[model samples]
Target: MTDILDAAVERAGLPVHWSWRIEVRPRRRTLGLDVLPDGSIVIAVPRQTTPEDVTGVLRERRLWLAKAVRRREALAAEHPAKELVNGEGFTYLGRHYRLLLVDEQTAPVRLRGGWLRLRGDAGAADIVDWYRVRGRHWLIEKVRSWAGRVGVEPPEVLVRDLSTRWGLRTKDRSLAFHWASMQLSPDLLDLVVVHELIHLLVPRHDDEFRQRLLVALPEAVVLESKLHDEGRRVWMGAVRAAL
Candidate 1:
């Protein structure tokens, strides 16, 4: 359906640069715009939807799409592409560490003297994998700490590179967290863990849920607002680059 979407974009005269992919799925009930981590768009619709229908929504949301593009471009400018070379910086635990490529290091990644002393042969993917490995352990520990305080047993915690969420709680009470959570400050990370652990008792973001969340962690709203403003600036594109 690329031709259909392309034709619609031309007809609408939208100045979008990314190639928007039109996907007709079997179970989709409504239309939505998805900005991929790699700065692409996906228009997901129901199986039998027409290009005309998609075009109408696109035109209607022209302003929103424009804002999305501006936001993406701003982020791109703030966090330009990394060459993964020596002296390049990466974030860990909300602190910046400059990379120092070494020849005889055994570990793929390590921190020394305010520097991320990485093996000269290792690449960006290797650093991301290292973060993922360390993130799993940190998230598990945080989950256990918060769950204990909330009178809930810790569920199965796993870390993966998520595109748009910091953490998710499944129906079975198991939890999954984005590896990018490791880059957030400790307070923000605590908020994320507390937010998800509260999901065990309250499934929705209702008033009761908010109250309970505050009872567990008082600074939820304030910190979450900051996180919204600070946003998930997963800049180096490690999440998508490794994928």
Candidate 2:
């Protein structure tokens, strides 16, 4: 199957700048193309899909696939990593706070005197936990406010590592946010909050959804662009041994 798809993509004459793979999804009814966060392409198709069909679909979506891959590549290049050391900077709600290693602390991490205080023994995981705890509390209130503006009840909000996504509205009608998003500015954070809240009303990103989102966030276009640019700089748990 892999050889056949590779040959098909070659015959399709698509640009070779991006990496791609084929996935046979047993339950998938139609061909789907996805550009992963790291700029890899995934071509998902039903089990019996032929190389010819895959080639045709790829050709039809060639322009879109190129654009998506370029965007992912740009983001991958801009993504930032962190070092777990004193004087290292961490962002919370768009504010940069220097990490201060302390000999003793009540918790593994805490914000005190405008510094992100970390216990000398704590590792990167502890810092992530700190963000989760802080983000959950902040998002709960944020979700409530956005929900009210969208004329819907606030759903249960959770904060954790959401991988490539910044936010998700689950089937249970609850909202889950990536803890890294706590690094976003308050305005960008509000955009994310209101985006999920609006999803509670509109399930898909269609025209109606865009109209409603614009009503809720007048500066959605500008803020979304900024979010994409700034979000790449947020620390996503990568840490160096020392700087």
Please provide, for model 2 over 79-125, each residue's C-alpha lDDT reduced to its tens digit, 9 standing for 90 to 100.
Answer: 65578888999999999999999999889999999999999899889
TM-score to native of every candidate shown: 0.68, 0.70
Sum up the clashes in candidate 2.
Answer: 0
Q: Where does candidate 1 stray beyond 4 Å? A: 1-72, 78-80, 236-243
Q: For model 1, how does the per-residue alpha-carbon lDDT over 118-148 read when each residue is reduced to its tens digit? A: 8878877787778888989888888888999
Q: Which residue window of length 10 is worst by lDDT in model 1?
A: 234-243
Residue 166, candidate 1: Cα error in Å is 0.1
Q: In candidate 2, residue 137 scores what lDDT?
A: 96
The residue pairs in collision within model 1 are none
Clashing pairs in 2: none
Report, for every candidate in turn, its global Cα lDDT versus the true structure: 0.79, 0.89
| Candidate maximizing lDDT | 2
